[model samples]
Target: MIMYTAGDVRVEERPDPKIIEPTDAIIRLTATCICGSDLWPYRGVEPADHTAMGHEYVGVVEAVGDDVRNVKVGDFVVGSFVISDNTCEICRSGYQSGCVHREFVAGTIGTQAEKARIPHADGTLVPTPGQPDEDLIPSLLAASDVLGTGWYGAVAAEAGPGRTVAVVGDGAVGLMAVLAAKQLGAERIIAMSRHPDRQELARFYGATDIVEERGDAGVARVKELTDGLGAHSVVEAVGTQESTMQAINSTRPGGRLGFVGVNYDVTIPGIDLFFAGIHVEGGPAPVRRFLPELIQLIWDRKIDPGRVFDLALPLDEAAQGYKVMDERRATKVLLTL
Candidate 1:
């Protein structure tokens, strides 16, 4: 077993975790991610100290409890970054990510560790067709966090055919929002980007336009493109006051705004929002709501979300992974156990 302690995470052999209840399962992690939200806790923005740090992972079920009916030992599984048993009232309502008995797997289950003890296994884990090819693991892991968040953002934005969508921010989730809009049949996608590399990737992911400028200049460009009506939908992928304002201002009256950035120093202006007449919606993206469909999309190779991960590091180099993302040297970092 590995430990995520204060200061830094380390690997050491310990007693293997066992099924503490019939609903529990043991997952031998194959791949995991260093999430952008994890940064809040790691950077002391959240009161996290010596907490198990990680929320996204893909793995094989090493063992299963007797009562666990959906998954079995030896099956390949991809679980949401947040764990929830699918049978709860909320799960049945398609909000398993917020199930009444939901138990997040990040800190307690600790996906960053080599192995994880998952509770509410049936509701939390979704099985794939078979052991995925090595190249597919990263994409599967994306299903656990960024991909789901992006998909949720798009859905919330009301992305669809004939809709013009503007995506604020260029993080992995933002880039995936571009992909999600395209997949959902949006007629045009404007990716607000300043970095050439991210801009190129945005285009490759199906962004029909690129706004190199930001703030008011970016909003002006969006208006110019939309005949002064602004886009019909706006995706806010960076949780900041500036990006939030940019998203709100970029949408036309009656348009929808989907925001998924983990809010940091973000305060919505009541007057601006009310007068914009844009329908704003979003939160801690209910990823589990979209996991089944996204998992199938990956399985069929209809889309590849793994491309957002630009760097891979051993789990031991987790701190470096954080530094790389903080320094903007990598679009995203994948941690291998």
Candidate 2:
């Protein structure tokens, strides 16, 4: 997929990716998908500039560089959206997304094509237990980004036993956050949304409450459910200023807020943040850090993140995929190769 300009993406033939670094490996992607983040550039919120698209992928290693040893040709693997050495001090501290050598996989190495070249393969890719079944591909592919992102949001918010986790978005990431909060043992998961379909899915993902309201009304509903103290943990998967503030106001003092949304214009006054006195953690999720555990859960059939893809189109139809998402017609679109 190539975006010639904002809202003008098309599937165009591009040069095939080959190893340019000894630490690189080329993989024949079996599955790839359009992400919520992809919409930023597509919607003109971010630059497109004839950019190559897609970052989430799952595939078989087609070839490997001499320096690569962790995975070999024929290995079915999943990699992170961000490339990381996975050995630097930051990565060792569990923040691979912030590694000294970090590189985003989006525009530089578009995985929406039949194949892609991956750098830092040793640290970025994790092979599955074995060859995955056809039905498992989507779920496995999801571990590359959305599922891992949601899991990070949950973990950052400290969603666990006796905690009330309120997710302030009903997109794929938000729905996945609801699932993550459940897996993390959050006692009450509150999914904030007005969409009936999303609300239903949230329930299936273990949400005990739903806030159909927005802004102040939404915060009041959450507070009502939490006895006016606000939720113990709040996940902000929507990156707008309104959504961010809603998440902040919905959190109790001394509670935690995990923000995984990718909006750039969101700003908060220092006084408000200082007075809120809430613990805040968020940013691009370190998906590589949780790939192992997420893969296991999917392999064991403990969670079905694949259901998040309500729309599927061949790689050629990515333009339509972007349209549907931009128009709110689909929560997610899985681009099949």
Candidate 3:
């Protein structure tokens, strides 16, 4: 799929990508999806003009360059949205998204096509145990981005036993975070959403509480639930300034606030943040770090993150997928090849 301009996307023919480096690999995509992050460009918050779209994907390896060792051609694989040389020092420390040679795979290298060239194959791509069942494909594709991202968000917030975890957005990422919090053993999981469908999904994912307010009302409701002590961990899935502050205010002193939403216009007040006394950690998720376990969870039928994709369309209707997501008609859109 190519974005001809802001709010305009269409499937345009392009040359099949080829390996550009010895570490590169070419894969024929089986499935891909539109992300909330993609809306940043679609909504024109960021520039877009004849730009390639999409990053989340799952596929079979068609070819690999000489230096690639971990995965061979014909392997079923899933990769992080951010390309990374997982061998780098930063990656070695479990932050592959911050690798010295990191490159975002979205705008620059769109995987929403039939095939794509993946750099740092051994580091960025993780092949499945085997050819997944047809029904498992969507879950596997999700592990490439949203699932891994939400898992990272929960981990960053330190959602664990005896803790009360609150999620700040009702989008796919936020829902994933709720699932992660449950798997991580949080004592109480709070999902803040005004949408009924999302609220129902949140309950399915183990949300014990739901706050239908926003801004100060949302913060007050959280505090009320926590006995005036806010939640132990708060995951901020929305990137606006209001949501950022809402997440921060919803955390108790010395608590954790994990922000996975792509911050576009968030600017915190230095004085308030200083006195907030909370631990904050967030950014482009190091999805490669969590892909292995996430894939296993889906493979084992322990989690069904694929339920987040409510709309499915062929690659030819990529425009409709973008339209539905931009209008919030679909929580997430799956593009079938």
| TM-score of model 3 (CA atoms) | 0.99
lDDT of 1 by residue, 1-337 (tens): 1334333545455567889999899999998878777767666666664577778888999999888999999999988877787777887887776788877776676788788888888888899988898989999999898999998899999999999999999999999999999999999999999999999999998999999888889899999999999999999999987888889999999999999998978888799999999898887667878888998999999999999999999987877887787777998899897
Over 79-173, each residue of candidate 2 has an lDDT whose tens digit, in order, gives 99999999999999999999999999998888878999999999999999899989999999999999999999999999999999999999999
lDDT of every predicted structure (CA atoms): 0.86, 0.94, 0.95
Q: Cα deviation in Å at residue 189, candidate 1?
A: 0.5
Candidate 2 vs candidate 3: the lDDT winner is 3
* Angstrom error at residue 71, model 2: 0.8
TM-score of each: 0.95, 0.99, 0.99
What RMSD does each model have against the real structure? 1.9, 0.7, 0.6
lDDT of 3 by residue, 101-195 (tens): 99999899998899999999999999999999999998999898998899899999999999999999999999999999999999999999999
Number of the predicted model whose lDDT against the real structure is largest: 3
Worst 10 residues of 2 by lDDT: 9-18
Off by over 4 Å in 3: none
| Candidate 1 vs 3: which has more lDDT | 3
Residue 139, model 2: lDDT of 93
